[model samples]
Target: MKQELRKQFGDEFQYEIALNGNEALEVVDELVEAGVNVILILSDWLMPGLKGDEFLILIHAKYPNIRSILITGHVDESAAERVKREAGTYAVFSKPWDSTKLMEAVRICCNKN
Candidate 1:
């Protein structure tokens, strides 16, 4: 799925493949160390090892400059509200996503001069 998006975007974007939350964090850490500027992050809410909001919290603690969009279907409204309050989530999407809206939101979030 993401591969197709990468193909569509071409050199306008780059991607890192990670098997899980820990791996994703490791990749993020490396990017931060290398001074790579990521304008936005879109992450799934449910993942092995850590929830999406939890992982985003960790990333936010370290890299507050990055914006985050969370996708989830495993939680209720109360849980979503709590996550938004506690985790600084920029936006949330329900599962079975809409690709057009997602891409538009991505562009809005990642816009640079």
Candidate 2:
């Protein structure tokens, strides 16, 4: 997925990867301190430490302007609804997602910011 994103967007955007939710938050803090405008986040539902929805909610609370896209192999309807409501999730994709749709969504989110 990372390779696909880079191939699709090239150097147009700076992409960062984190091993887990905590690391992701740290990266976000560093980027914020560096005056980077973090417009979007793409997260997996399952990861070490905080779950993706939980992490997105936390991020939304701290950085409301940031939009998020969630990729999950498994998530319940209620959880999806909650993230959409509380985290301002821009999109959600299931596992084995269509590359075209994912890229299109990314493009839309990037353009919005």
**What is the per-residue lDDT of model 2 for residues 1-113, given as tens digits with 9 covering 90 to 100?**
78998898788888999999999999998998899999899999899999999999999999999889999999577878899999999888988888899889998988932
- Candidate 2: TM-score? 0.95
Q: Rate the local accuracy (lDDT) of all candidates.
A: 0.76, 0.91
Model 1 agreement with the true structure over 1-113: per-residue lDDT tens digits: 47755755767877766667788899899987898886677788788897778888888888887887788877567757765777677678888778777776776777722
Worst 10 residues of 2 by lDDT: 104-113
The C-alpha local distance difference test score for the whole of candidate 1 amounts to 0.76
In model 1, the runs with Cα more than 4 Å from the true position are none
